[model samples]
Target: MKRYLLSLRLFWTTALSAQLEYRFNFLIELIAMLGTLLGSVFILSLFFSHGNKIGDWTWEAALVVQGVYTLLDGITNTFLKPNLSEIVNYVREGTLDFVLLKPIDSQFWLSTRTISPSGLPEICLGFSLIIWSSNRVSNGIHFDHIAIFIISLFCAIIILYSFWFLIASTTIWFVKTWNATEVLRAVLASGRYPVAAYPPSLRLFFTLVLPVAFLTTVPAQMILGNINLLKLFTSLLFSIIFFNLSRYFWKFALRFYTSASS
Candidate 1:
């Protein structure tokens, strides 16, 4: 375990060094992202100006939902998305063989080999918005609420990772799954809004089918003191099931890997 951790630290340091080699490009990308985020906020403000509250959630509540979603999205984009998106390329180009030959767990190595420091801006922006929204809300934040929120948020992160792993593992069958990651992004993007804002059928689908509700909405609700015990338990149960299923799928996919150019 210590060796694995040490390897991960070394890998991260290498990735950081590589990124720093082209620091100007990273800054440009960060600026572009900031602009895009500002545009999104402007659009949301205009929509809320129409005074339409979707379901029981007000615009303020929607802001909270988006804040949590953005924070989690930043975490994934920083740590996992870059590597997972390239897994198909690694498999097709035979680079994955190098990873497989390593003594460490290939999945761990592949998933954590890269990190995007640019994502830190989005994470900071999201937390700022979360704090601002909490202050605006009538129910004051309490220590217990914050603790539950942190716990639920961690579970949500696990759910997101497992779900993405399931999609990335499909590369073994498809051999070119770049489009699959895009599809996964589209599906997860919907979680930026409160699940209650959707139709009943869509809500059910998000909660049970894709489980995006547990990823952002449920955790945000827990912090807001609006989460139910039943929902919390359900989220916990789904997290466990999805994680185990993802592991099984990854193992199954590995069994079929013949390696490129073999």
Candidate 2:
């Protein structure tokens, strides 16, 4: 465990150093992130412009959902996209052999080999929005609520990573899964709005099928002091299931791997 921790530090430090070399890119990313966030808020405002509440969610509450989505999206950009997207290329080019040969776990090495600071601003802004909006709706943040929110948010992140890795693992059989990843992204985009805002059919689909509700809405609700133990338990259960499924799928896929030398 200590060795792995040391390795993680080295991996991120190296990645951060490399990213810093192109410092101007950070400014570009920050500007783009701000523009996107503002545009999202503008569109959200249009829904409540005429005193229309989305489902039972007030504007502030809805912003909490958006904040959670943004936070997850930032994580995707920072970690999942940079690392998981390379799985397909590694498979196609036979580079995965090198990865598998490493003393560390291949999944660990692949998933945490690099860090992108471009999404750091988005992450910071997401947390700020979540706190600001959540406080407006409920009494100022409670320690208990914050603790529960952190737990739910951690589950959400695990679920998100599992979904991505599940898709990425298919590279063992299908060398190009880019379209699948895009479809997942499109589906996940719906998470920016409260799940209740969706039609019944879509809401059920998002909750049971894709589990998008757990990704954003549930966490938002938790932070807003609407803590539902059942929902939180469900989220925790789903995260564990998804994560294990992804891990198992990767091992299964590796059984079929044929190195370039072969």
List the candidates' TM-scores in order. 0.93, 0.93
How far in Å is the alpha carbon of 38 misplaced in model 1? 2.5
Clashing residue pair totals per candidate (backbone < 3 A): 0, 0
* Minimal lDDT window, size 10, model 2: 43-52
lDDT of 2 by residue, 48-77 (tens): 575557899988899899889888888888
Candidate with maximal lDDT = 2
Tell me model 2's lDDT, rounded to 2 decimals: 0.89
Per-residue error at 155 for model 2, in Å?
A: 0.2
Error of 1 at 99 (Å): 1.0
Report the C-alpha lDDT of model 1 over 39-65, residue by residue, as the tens digit.
657765775677567688777777778
- For residue 85, give model 1's deviation from the true position in Å: 0.4
